[model samples]
Target: MINVFFDKVEFFANNKELIKLIISNKRDKKSDLKKVIIKLIELKTELKLSFAYNHNTKDITKNFGINEGIILIQNLLKTDFFNADLFSTNETVQLISNKNNKVKIKTTEPTFKAIPKLNHDRIKKQRIFTQNNIYLQELGIISQNGKIKKDKHDKFRQINKYLETIESLLQESYWFTSGKPVTNLRIVDMGSGKGYLTFALYDFLTNSLNLDVEIIGVEFRQELVDKCNVIAKKSGFKNLKFEQGTIEKSEFKRIDILIALHACDTATDDAIYKGITHNSELIIVAPCCQKQIRKQLNLTNEMAAILKFGILKERQAELLTDGIRALILEAYGYKTKVFEFISTEHTPKNVMVTGTKISQKKNNSEILEKINSIKSFYGIEYHYLEKLLNNLSV
Candidate 1:
């Protein structure tokens, strides 16, 4: 049997185990390897992944003659360990050098040379879940650092980007007033379920960056809230906490950054309202459902023509709803931006509306007018955003 093993002298996620699994499942090993190589090339083309395997070794390595920048080990058990120089050419990828816990074999070499060693300890340290000790958290109720359940791909990506963007927004001058910078960053995540992003953000700001941040996650589920609280306590994160609250009834206070990720439709709007009401410096919303907008569009007379086509009407409703919300933010002196969080391919509805409350141009009349014009063109009335625009100060 031609045995192949991948050793982490390169990267953890790119271990030889992946090759073993692929080779085992594949119909034609060579063809499957070819596919993998092609996939690597494709990833390289897109700059999604860097080169992984190293190029040099002893006599056995010469026999294999690496493919996809990889060498197959015929007797992987005999060898104690191996490493892939994923970033031999450029130091940016990684410098891996580690032992095989199972085989008890170890190898060490310079990063660029054929002999490589992946720093498994560092790789293990990098995984957010492991590094943060999420596994130790309670079940049913998710803690701030709880292990994320599978099948939440959409939420994961959105939450990650939303948190980072808010951090970046804080650095912008528009988010400040009278040149008085908002140095003490306080953020609250409303309807914060599982706190995948909440914990992720705290990890970034507090542990990784060592920035002094006050972070809170508010969720209706008491269990999840309690779980988060425990995790916060255990992590020794004084600035992080979780509270039980609803967006509608929750009393939002002194929040510099407010985020609502996939707060179910109108709930997302409510979260936005609370942020603006509390005079939050930055508001980022990734709304999940648009059921309210969908229903309102059906009832409004102006939307009748567009409603003629169900598909067209649905798309129109989505755009109109978000557009009105954008205008409302503008009315409150918040500069709003709407963009795709992911894609329809990933999940049809991916809407992120970010707002920075600009003091001078709080209520940009031009932006408000443009939003109205868009509504008029689409015959969209009974807009939730428009309703709120008149309720609060810009």
Candidate 2:
């Protein structure tokens, strides 16, 4: 038997008919076939693909914005060599051909796709972090039967999304200088309630990304810290541990990433201050509770009518609080971004703030003036983050 792989197969212009034939007979029992995937187009904004399955029935599952790039498969004993032409902005393609006589292969550059749809069977079959993960089971995200709990479905998706974001961020060249890989990383997760995300991150960084990393999850609850430590030990995550401490009290000499998800009121500020003080490479937080700014926001003359409404005032405070935090991060020589983390259906506190430290310092007098003006206009004495950083050098 001969086997071959081709990366430059021209599908639309040449092999469309072949792909059609392959999908049409996807369920042929004699073929020993599994499935056929056809990526329709790669747009700058999204990805499109059709999955043709060959289990008990043959059906096509069309999906949009799937992140998996390409897959090629061949079965030599059955002469079932399958080649798929994956459409993309760059017109990328892959093909596998196995025959009795000879084999041939071709390769080329690869392009990235979007995250796969949730219903896609590949999500379960080829999960990057499997359901059998001991930490996930210990955390009750998955059942003892190695299945995701029905209620924890959203939680599972959130974990995957979190890992995906971190994976993409790690690929940036700025994180690695002169092609030297980062072997050691110290990550601190502030307010790590239940440690659901902390465990996922540690697993991905150590098991998936293959990085040597030490992770500390700081939670005020001693019970939770002890529980998480037990889970970490059971899962054999030697470099991953939990500590009973608040974000402000926790100290680390060196930190690579500082993460705080849904830290309440001023805790988000504490996390950011720690990241900035340690000069961490990355800081990510999904802030919750903006009462600090909301409580001090009086009905100013400029916007008394709108600010008088409770709902509007609350919404405005959330935005302003996070906005100021982003600006503060920027002024501290970190590139910052604020965006919706997830839908409100999953969690209302879904706004995520990301800060990546840059080499240049940017705490100019103008930035300070802007910060102060915003505070004064809202009648806020000090943004929690600002108050924390007032004595520290930016």
Candidate 3:
């Protein structure tokens, strides 16, 4: 059985169609070496194998010729590894080992296509926003010489990550996938301070994805609004514009995607309320300065002991505030997720909350009961988002 598996591997490798091979499920439990990932990389004149040694905590990579790679894989499989998965452009093959040392092989259709540039340097070049991007230059994230500024490296990564998230969400969205064809998409960015991410999203959707999109960046400061508008015009983003207004006061006829990052205090709640009221398909926000819940806390139960510490109390408030917000969104018939938007090293207030509208019918009583139970445990009166939603009905 092992010889048969080796014959299959040699066939794919010799044919130059082998994409990747993952050998895992260590037979030696005490070994720190975890798994081995091998991929075919095309060099200037020849194809070579890139072997990545994944350890318990670190990873190491080395390149080898095809024959040498096969030998190394055979040696590892005979001793250290018990299972293997091989991927090609056309199909995938899995090899499993039983307790009796018998091997079983299975084949299925391919899950991913081959990427020949398997090196670390080439992987860095695959970012969504490259250094030469016009918006990166305009936003001062990159220099005129097409180099990213040292100070803006984290900002650049954050922008790319944000756009990557948006792209993934769009691919999964019902409206984007199987719904009626959309000739145009409308997006609103509430409290868009400098329009950094707003411009990035517009560029990605319109230029990269080649979709018809109209984006509005709402800012309370007229200066920022004017500045972003000028940049949009100079950048030739015709449908993108900025408006001077607060999240609470801003009005939009339609919104397909609503984004509000780093909105302070109850302002995040205001943005969520706006998205819910407009029935936006997607809502994303990174909440900041969660002081409202801290001020309203009436803790007198077992948690009151932990609430004695000012810092711990502040953190608890932030957690409860976002938790209730997610529950409230679920009550409104939206699927919700709360996670870190970026690393704490980049910014302390990095928590992000998102809601994707799933159904028109809401689970009001059930979700509300859960929300009230949480509020009661924390000795809180109400969540700001719940209040806005409640007042909307009245």
Candidate 4:
């Protein structure tokens, strides 16, 4: 029976008709893996199998040649999985096995034609925002001929990377994964300089994903705000608009996703505070200029010798600043992450701090204690984010 399944798979592979294969019902109940899916993909005129391992927490995918894919399927079916479903262009085959080692094979005509798409280059072909997009051209990231401008290549990459990060976060959310309708979704971009990322995000969510979203870009300069508003109108982005306001002084309604990139000095703290106060589901910020912490540092500990150097002191301040911010967010019921947003080659300020609201209660006292210890070790008086959050009425 197992050999029969392999033969059928091989027959489909030979004719390039195999569409997808799913293996399930893990023989080992202790395994963390839930199931595995394999799909036929054409790469550069050659057929390959894209194997996706769906685990309880995450999914991993890899590509293999047709012959290699068949071998892998056979091995998994024999050792790991008890049930398999194979779909081809014309037929569907199901192999089911019981704990008694008895196997049953069922074959039927496919309900619908399952055609594989040519995916020669996944990254370039599957970008959220394409080169020929009107917003991209209007933003000067791409030329009218649909080619990325040489000078704006890094900016283009940064925009896509930002969108990718946001997309992944949305994918992990309950509303997205459960296929629930997220109506009246509101997003705010603080310190939106020139509205580059702001426009790209609106385009991706509304046009690409078909989500009903309203985005507001807040810029301090009135001229950039007006310019962005014009581009938004010209591009037919009806739900997207910009307003002139400073991060600290701006009035934000309830925001689902709050983004503030390159907010200088304590402005990043102001953004995070606003996000928290407004009950934002996700807070994203890229901080610039750690001058606040550098001014407050008065280290007399052993690390003071190393901090004596101006550059090292500045670097330490940046690390400590973002680190404390992450801790403060965790104290406020958010799962936080701090990482590099882009390469230094593109821009010097690359670190990004993100916080996604979580339902589970965190140990606020312990988190605050750790923050205090770090502050004491560095001879720091306080973090700006801490100061802002402290003043919030509970």
- Which lDDT value does model 4 have at 46? 79
Least accurate stretch of 10 residues (summed lDDT) in model 1?
16-25
Tens-place lDDT digits, model 1, residues 327-377: 778777787889886666666656789888776456467877887677666
Model 2: how far is 375 from its true place, Å? 2.0
Query: For residue 148, what is the lDDT in candidate 3?
Result: 81
Candidate 4: Cα lDDT at 162 = 79
lDDT of 4: 0.84
The residue-by-residue lDDT of candidate 3 on 42-160, one tens digit each, is 66656678889999899998888888888999888889989999987667889998556788999898765432233323433343455556667877888888888999989887887
Task: Say what the RMSD of model 1 is.
Answer: 13.6
Model 4 RMSD, rounded to 1 decimal: 8.7
Model 2 lDDT at residue 164? 69
**Overall lDDT per candidate, in order of appearance:** 0.56, 0.69, 0.83, 0.84
lDDT of 4 at 385: 85
Better model by TM-score, 1 or 4? 4
TM-score of 2: 0.69
Cα TM-score per model = 0.57, 0.69, 0.74, 0.74
- lDDT: the better of candidates 2 and 4: 4
Error in Å for residue 339 of model 2: 0.9
Cα misplacement distance, residue 277 of candidate 1 (Å): 2.4
Question: Per-residue CA lDDT of candidate 2, range 39-108, in tens?
Answer: 3443443333344545445654554332232232233213443344333323334434333333333334
| Rank ordering of all candidates by lDDT, starting from the highest | 4, 3, 2, 1
